[model samples]
Target chain A: MTAFLRRRSLLQGLAGGAFVLVAPRALADLGSRLDAALAERFGERRPEQGGVELELSRLVENGNSVAVTVRASPDEPTPAALHLFMPRNPEPWGTSFQVAPPALAEFSTRIRLAGTQDVMAVAEWADGRLGATAVSVMVTLGACADDLYLEF
Target chain B: MRRALLLLWLLLALPGHAEPRAGQISGYHLLGEELQALQDDDFANPGMLWVDRGQRAWDAAAGASGTSCRDCHGGPERMQGLATQLPRWNSDQERLENLEGLIRNCRSARQQAEPPAYESDEMLALTTVIAHQSRGLPLAVAVDGPAADAFAAGRDAFARRRGQLDLSCADCHDRHAGARLRGETISAGMINGFPLYRLTWEGMGSRQRMIRWCNEAVRAEPLQPDTAKALALELFLAWRSRGLELESPAIRR
Candidate 1:
C-alpha cells in the first residue's frame, strides 16, 4: 500500500501535479488550528499562576488515545470549566468539560494525539481567572486513519 | 482407591493456582493512583467517548429491520448486569459464546445486518456500551452443565505454560502478582474492565485482543480472536474475577 502511494506520487510529480494531492489532511496545518482553538477559548483571559494540574503519561505508547487527568486545586472556589487540547491532534479542540465544586474540579478522559506534543489544559476558576498547565508526551506511532485519501 | 484419589488431588493442584474462589480484586486495584482515579471518574475516562459512540449507534437504524439497538434493548439501564454473565453456553450451537459472539449473533440473527468484524470500531463501541451497562455489578457467570467442560478447558489453559518465555498466566498474574516483572508489577489478571481503553492502544479493544497481546508478548502463538481456545481463556479469567464489579471501559496504562 505504501509503495503504491509512493509510485503514485512519482507519477503525479511527472504529470505536473504537486505533492499536495498526496499529503494527508491531518498533515496539512495543525498549528493554525491550535492557535484558533486557543484564541477562541481563552480570548485574552491570561492564565493565572499555578492552580491547574495536568496529569498525562510522559511517554505515550500510542497516539490513538492517551489517558489524561486535569484537576484544579480545591483551594477556595473550585474550577468551573475545564478545556483540554492537544496541539498535535487532528483537531486541537478536543473537548470542553464542566467541573462542579463538589466534584473538585477534576476531568479525565482519553484523547488522540497525532504526534509527540504538549497536552494543554486550561481551567476557568470560580474567581473568573484562568489557570493552565501542560505536559509533554512522546508518541511512538500515531493512530492509523482509514480515511487517508490517496489521489489516484 | 484412596491412594489413587490422593494422587489425583496432588496432580490437579500441582500445575498452578487453580482454586476457584467466591471473589477477587478488580484489576482497577492493580493500577496506579492516576489510572485508578481515571476509572473512578466517568467524565474523564477516555472509554466514555467510545461509549457515547456506541450509544449513538444504539439509536441509529441499520440492517434489514432498519431498527436501532435501542428498539430492542431500550436503554442501558434496562440491560444492566448483562456483561457479567457472558461467554454463555449456547445450547443451540453446543458451544460457549462470549459477549462479542453474542453481539455478532444478534446482528446476524436479529438485526439482519452483517455483523461487524471482531475488534472493529462498531463491535468495540457496542461491546463497551453493553459492558458498561453491567458496571459495578458483580461478575457471576454460570459454569455448570454445558458450560462445565469449557470452564475446565479454561482452567487448563490458565495453568499450561506457553511461549518461548516458558510462562503461564498463573506464573505472573497468580503467583507473582505483587512482584515486579521488568519494572512493572503483575496483578492478578482480571476481565471486569473488558473492552477497556488501554493508554497504549489509545483506543478500545476486546478481551480477545488483550489475551492475544499477552500471548505474543511471551513469544507464544496467539490464538485467533474469539476462537474456542480464546473463549475458553476469557471464560477462565472472568470466573477468576468472580466477585468484582464490572468495570468495562475502564482506563489502563
Candidate 2:
C-alpha cells in the first residue's frame, strides 16, 4: 500500500511539473498563443475585433517586405500601446508602439509575413480595453534565410 | 544675404525644380497609410530583424586584430547623429565616402579585417547597427567646405538625364515627387535610411542597392555601389534630406 502511494505521489508531482513547464511555452509560440500573449501585454480581458483599423494590401508580389497601418477611429478612445502580430511567423509579435495623448491615434509600419496569412494588431486603451483587427496578406516569395554556406 | 542665398538655391534647382521654392517631401509622407503603420510598429517591422542581427555582429569579434566593433566604438548610443553627417568629404583621402565606403575603410584599416562585399549580410548588418544609432535624428550634411566639390558633382549627376527612358533622378524625385507612377507614389530620393530593410529583398540591403534598383528602373546602366559616381549621388541625397529625420533600418516597399 505504501509503495503504491509513493508511486502515485511521484506521478502526481511529475504531472504538475509538466504543467508548469509546458504552460508558459504553450503561451510563447504563436499559433494560438496570441490570446495569451495579448493577455500578458494588456490583460486577461478578451478583445473584440473592431474600433481598430488595420490596413494592408490583399496581395504582394514578394513576402520580403510589406507595409501595414493601424489606426483608431477618430471617435474611439485612444490606445495606450499598439502591438502587431503575425500568427505564423517564426516569432509572432513584430513590435509595439506607445501612444501618448493628445497625439494622433494613428500609427504605421512595415512588416514581413511568412506566407499567405492574416496579420493582426491590438490597441490597448488607457482604460485597459482593447480594440483589435486583422488584415490578410499574400506573399509570393517569403523571407529567405541567406545560405551563407553557398556565399562563403 | 539670405535673399541672395535663396536666389542661388533657386537657380541651382531651376533646371529641374518645376515650381518656385518647391518644398521637399520625405519618403515617410509619400508612403501609404499601411506602410507608415508598419514602420512605426517595432515588433513586426522586418527591418528590426536586421537590426537585431546587426546588434549581434557588433558584439562579435572579427579581423586579424581579433577585435569587435564595441572595442573601439564604445556603444551604439554614442553613434547617435553620426549617420546624419555621412557621405561627407574625407580631406585626408581627398575623396567623398559614403557610409559603406567608410565602413570598408574601417574594416580594412582599423580592424585589419577583410572588408565585406558591397552589400553582403555582414556589411548590411554592421551598417544597420550604425544607422539604428541615428534613428530619429534630423538629417544634417555639410554640402560646403571640402564637401562642396563632391556635392556639386552629385548635383550635376542629379540633373543629368540618362537611361533608355531619358529620365534623370531629378525628373521623377524632384519634379514629380508627389505624383503617382503606375499607382506608386514618387518620393524625393532621400538617403536618410541608408541601411534599410526592403520588402522586395525581404532582408536588409544597403542604400547603394536601393539606388541601383532605381537606376535599373530607369533602364540606365547602374553604377557600382562603391563607385565615385554613386557616392556623389549619395551626397546629393543626403543634402536633400537636410531637415528630415533619419529612419535608418527603415522599411520600404
lDDT (tens digit, per residue) of candidate 2 on A9-117: 9999999999999986754555465665666666668677787888878876445566678888667877787788887787777888887978776876657677777
Taken over the whole model, the C-alpha lDDT of each candidate is: 0.75, 0.74
What is candidate 2's lDDT per residue for B23-75, written digit by digit as tens? 45456654445666667888876778778887898888888989888899877
Identify the candidate with maximal TM-score: 1
CA shift at B199, candidate 1, in angstroms? 0.8
C-alpha displacement of B2 in model 2, angstroms? 31
Worst 10 residues of 1 chain B by lDDT: B6-15
Candidate 1 TM-score versus the reference: 0.63
Q: For each candidate, what's the DockQ?
A: 0.07, 0.09
Candidate 1 lDDT by residue in tens digits, B67-106: 7788998886676887999888999999889878988888
Who wins the DockQ comparison?
A: 2
- The 10 consecutive residues of candidate 2 chain B with the worst lDDT sum are B1-10
As a whole number from 0 to 100, the lDDT of residue B9 in candidate 2 is: 43
lDDT of 1 at B103: 82
